[model samples]
Target: MTDRRVQKTKKAIREAYLSLILEKETPKITITEIAQRADIDRKTFYLHYDSIEDIIHEFGRQETEALILHLEQNDFFDDTADMAALFRALNALIEANLELYQHIARTPSYAFLWGQIKDILKVSLTETMGERLDIPRAQLEICAEFYASGTISTYLAWLRGDLPMSDDQLAEIVGDIAYYGLHKLISPPKAEGDEG
Candidate 1:
């Protein structure tokens, strides 16, 4: 019974927070406001959360976990280099939580989201090593770190409107770049009216 109650309270708090976020910025919210919105007392809020940020952090964790599961099921783990599913899942996630993304990106907790993605990629890529990478452990670590950073940076750029591409297009472009190198996405421009 206690477990169920705890789940209910946590769910209530998260739901309230989402509703409030849709109407106002996260900075302007408080425990009292969330309690009122959730129809719970301050004590109930504290019972399940240390602060609004705690709940938000947990929410981000839960969201990233879901994304990872989705990615794995789609065979993102088939190979260390199979990042297309990961990118697709990421695109869907950002689109689904655009408002929350805008809010969380403004807070210190924003790093947690990217951090989670990096960790997930590291683990998934590590798993894809059938018999361990032939490179030195330190070297492989560096490469994985670079790839994960590049993946996260691309999504961040998409969020910031650095490119006119849609999320799917961006994902595909990123996949091409990661798998086929820069030449896949860009070739030298031909003279006007030039044909292949």
Candidate 2:
């Protein structure tokens, strides 16, 4: 078990890094600024992390771990839970940490976090639906990628405040799109006489 002081220190460091990243690029930040923002000495910062890149990497890892934990705890792929529930759970998590996620969206080094979540979603889909699938392996992979990327992009847009919809609204939209495809999204071709 880690000491409470250690946990507190680490949390401070993470909070500082997140705040700094929001104001400026990760590459522009220095250990001194982080230490000052975190209210810890440079030596203490060094004790916890080697560099800012390490902090970003650890943050990404922790975010992904939290997501996986949330999924597991909610029985994400269980029969009782549907895709909408999964998306809602995800939206809840993202909204709960909106600022952190927004900062990460702007940080180029943390870009892989989106891909990591996408890959996890793909594996979950494969495990849940693979046995029932009759399509070629490549096709299944493509399908998973489509859903994963679409959902991730949606969440990123939400984090950036580009989406006008609330989390619940966005969740419903994503669930609808995933389950129903573009049938409802694409309007019937307008009659030749129809004019907007």
Top-TM-score candidate index: 2
Clashing pairs in 1: none
Q: Please list the C-alpha lDDT of all candidates, in the order they appear.
A: 0.76, 0.79
Off by over 4 Å in 1: 22-25, 79-82, 106-109, 129-133, 186-196
How many angstroms is residue 1 displaced in model 2 relative to the true structure, after the best TM-score fit? 6.6
List, residue by residue over 91-115, the lDDT tens digit for candidate 2.
7667777877877876567778788
Once fitted onto the true fold, the runs of candidate 2 whose alpha carbons sit more than 4 angstroms away are 1-3, 107-109, 131-134, 184-196
Task: Tell me the tens digit of each residue's lDDT in model 1 across 1-196.
Answer: 9899889889999999888876876688888999998999999899888888787679878887888788767877765466566678877778888766755555454687678877877666555652356877777767667767888777766666666787888888777775666886678899999989
> Which candidate has the highest lDDT of all?
2
